[model samples]
Target chain A: MMTTETVNVQDEKKSAFLGSISSAFQGAETYATLRKSAWDTLSKFAIPGTKTEAWKYTRVGKVINHSWMKSHGNSQINLPEIAIGGLRYVFVDGLFRADLSDELTYPGLNIRRTGENAENNLLGTLSNHQGDWFEALNAAFFNDGLVIEVDKNAQIDRPVHLVFFTSEENTASFSRNVLSLQESSSLHVFTHYIGSEHSTFSSVVTEAFVGKNAALKIDKIQEGNETAFHHVDWTKQDRDSRFDITTVTLKSSWVRNDLNIRVAGENCHSSLTGAYLPSGKEHVDNHTMVDHMVPNCESDEKYKGIVRENATAVFNGKVFVRPDAQKTNAFQQNANIVLDDTATMFSKPELEIYADDVKCSHGSTTGQFDEEAVFYLRARGIGEVMARKLLVEAFLADVITTLSDERLQTYCTEKIQQLMHS
Target chain B: MLHIKDLHANIDGTEILKGLSLDIKPGEIHAIMGPNGSGKSTLASVLAGNEDYEITGGSVTFGDKDLLDLSTEDRAREGLFLAFQYPVEIPGVSNINFLRTAVNEIRQYKGEEPMSAGDFLKLVKERSALVELDGKLANRSVNEGFSGGEKKRNEVFQMAMLEPKLAILDETDSGLDIDALKIVAQGVNAMRSPERSFVVITHYQRLLDYIVPDFVHVLYKGKIVKSGSKELALELEARGYDWIKEEVSA
Candidate 1:
């Protein structure tokens, strides 16, 4: 713990720095009190230190103390183009680029930019980003992201993609997004976070409200540069809804994602999965919390991590079944493979239940590759490299193949192989 | 041609083969019959270059290469195949794919281009038919859920696919039924040629009944105790290995 004098100095420096660049950053100041309340939350609970229980395996002080938190002004060039055929909305450095985005015209869907419309009809939700200290910081400083509304009983035929690309190494960018699906609506979403060779800091916060009998499938891919740092997302669910969420992280020198999902309604089904591959001095940590507050809802989670060289990967999955959430079928599994002797992996799969009739189980395993399987493949004339690749893919098939989309599945598989071999 | 001169091997510091010698010609099929603890399987493993067995004082010559210096896979590429007593089961690897990879790798080692997919598929169909293997079984993981007889039949199917010059069968009839034994023997007999030789290692004379060998050798305690014509197998079957043990001791 730091002394009182040092704490005050750090706070003074942080606010002074944030205040100096406040004039250059602007999105929509539609909710004055909401932004003030968000700032208050961050002040009450500052960035955590290493002594904090939740920050035991990670340290964020170095990131918070850096000068990259300063704002940038219209630092724009023609960003790298992508040929993927989807309705994409592009953002560079937390600023929307209309030249790079697609035209938003579809039935039962409503899109509005934070810069185009302050508060953007998502006023109340925007004011309530107090999940954690980092989220509060995101709420206080976030300038632009997206706000999408799906009408009741609407069914989206095509996936909507959101690309967040960054190309700065000495500044920070924060994007806050809001999504709502009324009764019986369904949609699929793809979110990509890409960075140039060196990006200093980045943060993303998403708040969702899923109505009764609604369905939402979200596939998130984080393929930033080795110098890129930081990510955070939060979501909430309503009654009788279905949520299928998948997250894949390939690169990033230091990244921490905080996902808190609350299923407030009965009979809801939620499945959360993630695959994180890191190598060569990278550090990626995922802290997920799924709260089941009502009865008869089920949730399943499986996370796989592969790390080599001196990299470290951490997975902490916490599932909580409330007192009245009976007959809940919740299963959680976390498996990891540390290839090189210098790599490290930390896996903690937790389950807390108060209902006696509920069924909940969690299993965690971390080990090296099975040598017998390798020898068997080699004996069949496959070389060592190709043999190991086949074995690794087979090991991760159960999780990565869960993606129902064929193109996306192949993309993820190739990306994983490239990173692992690199 | 294959020759073993004063072969000696050890497993975990325990000597299993002591001064064993044999000569195999290119056109002859020989049956090696032995009892338990007679170094039968050890010879098969050492010939296949299993790392568990150390060659202490031995020299094995196959064709133009010193067999001891070659790797297990290199030996396979050089037209040497071993039908293991217990074929290893590998999950998540297709049986047909494994065979094709083995065949192509062997061809590549011999400086030949890979076979086309269509031709390879045709070959698989023909080879699979030799043992009456189900078409769907080729798509399944290698020997994962196979019955004991099916596993033995798969070994013969693989042998037909690879078409090796020297095939070593180690205890191929341990637990097979009469029908499976006939099928396995038929597959091997169909592939027999003047240029390809076979060393069939078995503990019973029943397998040799279907595919008679040119000669029969009784392996007792680490050496070949007797060598005679195919009629020797029926004599050893009528009397048991104990009679051969007594004869060798005398």
Candidate 2:
């Protein structure tokens, strides 16, 4: 009888999820075949449980099985000002807001909203059904997002900002963004995912193709309410492009970021830096993977986490060096600080190597703030609270200051200072 | 300027400093020489408000304020400084930035306006030179990647910057070479004034040759057992601490 009840619960969840996905894209002839195939592939793999190797540290069954995974809205909202000079694209509740966005007139750039009128199926081609249920779910259900293209040899003076804000409660939303760059092109994206202080589910899947010798940098930040759940982020880089991805999570109970960089061509350089603070029983999981597929490539990853007041954080960083990827130099480090004994952190930095010649080193450490350092500051007349804040900022400076743009770096610095105080 | 009477402190329920007493007057430089396990560092830590040590029974008054009632930072703002024997390495915190914050905080506590950027930078340039600290080193992380001599010099530099009324130097000459010791002593000597006092704690009398303490005290087994003039340090140095132990036992 118990076995029957457990099976019944899971079957009910599966049917409900599949039903929502099929109806959402039922009339979409553009991606009808792709959507069906993706759903079929995703149904083959069950949602990860505690027994799964990659999911052992982060049990996502509860997060994925939750009931709020269907509805989305297009309510207009006020967006917070972050940058001074930039091309802005605003989205409310996962739907683009044209009135709030800027009219594009810059050279060598083009952007269009995705719908049935769109010509390409890059979403299906760029995203594969990795055993990850989140990505697979995103592929099966994502309805609309923006497709950006940069011309060859053209450099955008200012950054391109994508602001996503959640206004409804107990609703799930997904956005699939695709960006392509031509040879020697360069672009910068300052992305934000913000939500109200309610239980909102949001998933954003970004697929980027960087051509030969092109460079791209994406600074993604998540600021949601403490009660919100259901967040998944994915990005893929290609060819000899220089790619740098920085993700900072300020508030959210459940978030999963799958940041993958593919060194497809030789002599490519990629870097990923993440800074997160999980407070008050919040949980933030980051799974970063960099695949060195070609020879003469280098990658560096740094992640910093602060687990405060019974909160928890999980960092699982993986680096893959293919057999042909010789002369690869990959380095990864994850440092965390748990404020009290109640707080917990799980760090699993993994390296899967098939190459013979590589200089790679990865390390992780989790501890409380250095008492001696705090006291050293205090002994110099810094107040106790100020001292703690200073040390916390100092701990996160490595990752926070890695933003290439000076303005973006200052923005992050000020945000970090506010977070430390809050 | 500072006074400690019947100071009894312990760590982890073990008695470390038992009924220790000391008095400091303005413009006085007193050197306390002691052997191992003699509570010299413990005294320094207790005076600096390190929480690891508990005062079971004691009375500490500094600048007419109850020293035991204030926190570590308040003690600092009240004109008490401790030059740590082992300075901690705080990475990513620029030395210049932290010193500026410390100075501003102290100034704020004293009802003074914040220093301007130009003035602060100028002060930093002048102070970093007192200990012969490298300009680049002073701009990097606090004490990070600093050598032993550099760390020691940083402590002295901080002391010069803070300009405490009563400064406690705990084993400042432990790992210094001859030249570093001379330079560090010069920094200390330069800060001496009629309104400033120092409590120099060390094992050897070699540092006294440069700083020239007016009085010398012997700390043995958590208490002071002997007191005399500056020549007492020379005699103890020439004879060694074993003779002091014998004298105390007798």
Candidate 3:
């Protein structure tokens, strides 16, 4: 009876905590009906515990137990220069900052703030909020975001750069974005997240649509400071379309990324690649899923990480092929290197194929540095530390080379080197 | 100059080199021929500071420094090179990049500036020609995907580039055809100078035909039992190692 009473009291406390967060944006004009329903779904479920199969290796107590205040826009902080030249957009505390951003006008592109486009129906269509705490939270309270639409048969020459800056203590922010590419269109996007040295939390959701014969590529870099970041990306590809994304996580206190891609049409191609380095008690988790709903589609995924100094990294990748998805080809691989004895890595690659005529493969590997390679390098007059560094760089070369932009590759490489020596 | 006095070493608590003694002067090539498991390669490993083998008792002096006290890389920076019988294949590390790093590191140890890019490339071109190494092979990963002959030639090419004071070739002529043997010998001969010395360790005397040695020594049961002029190698070749074993036991 005592245990039962304690469980009930804990449930009450969790409900009260979630209720307080939801009441902040009562009766908001952006997706009011959808937000109302999402909050209802969120209130029905408690925070996931360690027993949850999807989150067995990751602990979320640090994120859910805090009393976080909503972040207000702060436009006073200095912004760093953009690394690559492109049409740039800046978001501060989940609010778009036009003063710090480039001109939004460009050829063959339509860009708008969520508040400006009240008739847009693509915001809440792709991402599902049912039975998902983070998704529900993001959908119910996202204040403002960007909506991008590429014209039909248009080829955009310049890439789009989006920067999100958070500079507050004990605050939380939510943002949602949507990208729509018409038939035979092509575009590239780069996203960067920067945080100040204060305890903060942020959640971002992106819904993308790839039309027939369209091509879309995205590269993301996350640089965090005592921050808990949650990102969800839902992308749908049409017939003869191509979708590629590469995510590189440099630093963060805690991070959880969910990438879901659905092949809704035939002859579509999807490629996903990522590299992460976590040290100093940091925690990073990446969960990816690719669903094949039609015939004649291909999907490939590769993620690599280096864990050091008591850090933890978790990778779970799944590929699903439906009964009608005949002639589907899927491949997934996860590789990691644990640099310290105290470091931890959990990797699971799973495939669930219901189609009779499909080819699918998955692999996971976790290991330490090759001692023979180290000795060989040291034999050639290279120091012990430099030898290990060279080997680490070589191990990550393949993953980084998958990026389509050379400048982004160089930037990521330089950032990794800096973090390694730091 | 190199000197080894009463050297004793062990691997996994089993003795390999027992009370071995030798003296080598500059401008001299000494060939040490021995039967299988006769501790020829053990000497090379110990001199190169391989921690796998523990030196139980030994004193080695190389150019006025206690060679055994230094680390492996320090020994290399101090002008000692070893052309391993089986060169390591290090994928993803370009040959030119690795050599440049090595050259810069050695220069830094001697309080010198790094070599300019143009000068470094020129040096690479000039030295790689000594062994007739293909331009493509010179730019590829170190010893990766190379044939047996290419691997040996790469070792000699590295020896030429580093310009070490003393180089030990451990069974470098073992798996080479006649054509490859002549090319490897030519590369080594071109690097011979009064300021440099070579310790050529081989199981056969066929290599001695191209790169002539000043002296030949017979090592058996971890000890040098016979020392003579170059004719000793020929004698041992004509009459297999059985005669040397009998002579040592008698």
Expressed as tens digits, the lDDT of each residue in A264-347 for candidate 1 is: 898998998888888988888988888988889999998988888999888999999999999898989998888999999988
Q: Which candidate has the highest lDDT of all?
A: 3
Candidate that scores best on DockQ: 2
For model 1, how does the per-residue alpha-carbon lDDT over B95-137 read when each residue is reduced to its tens digit? 8777777888888989999999999999999998998888898
Q: How many times do residue backbones clash in model 1?
A: 0
* Candidates sorted by DockQ, best first: 2, 3, 1
Measured against the true structure, the TM-scores of the candidates, in listed sequence, are 0.86, 0.95, 0.93
TM-score-sorted candidate list, best first: 2, 3, 1
- Fnat per candidate: 0.27, 0.84, 0.45
Measured on C-alpha atoms, candidate 1 has an lDDT of: 0.79
Which clashing pairs does model 1 show?
none
Count of steric clashes across candidates, in order: 0, 0, 0
Off by over 4 Å in 3: A1-13, A25-27, A356-359, B235-239
Q: Each candidate: what lDDT? A: 0.79, 0.83, 0.87
Residue A39 Cα positional deviation in candidate 2, in Å, after optimal superposition: 1.3
lDDT of 2 by residue, A1-422 (tens): 00111222345567776676556544545566766776655666655556566666776654455565444455646677787588998877777777898985578898877653665656656555445566667767776678888999989888889987877766676777888888999999888888877677777878888888899888888888733444443444556779888888888777777777767898888989999998876888888888888889899999998898878899999999999999999999999999878888999998999999999999999988899998989998999998988898899899888776777777777877786677
Q: Against the true structure, what is model 1's DockQ?
A: 0.37
lDDT per residue (tens digit) for residues B18-113 in model 2: 899989999999999989999999999999999999999989999889999999999999899999999999998999889989989999999999
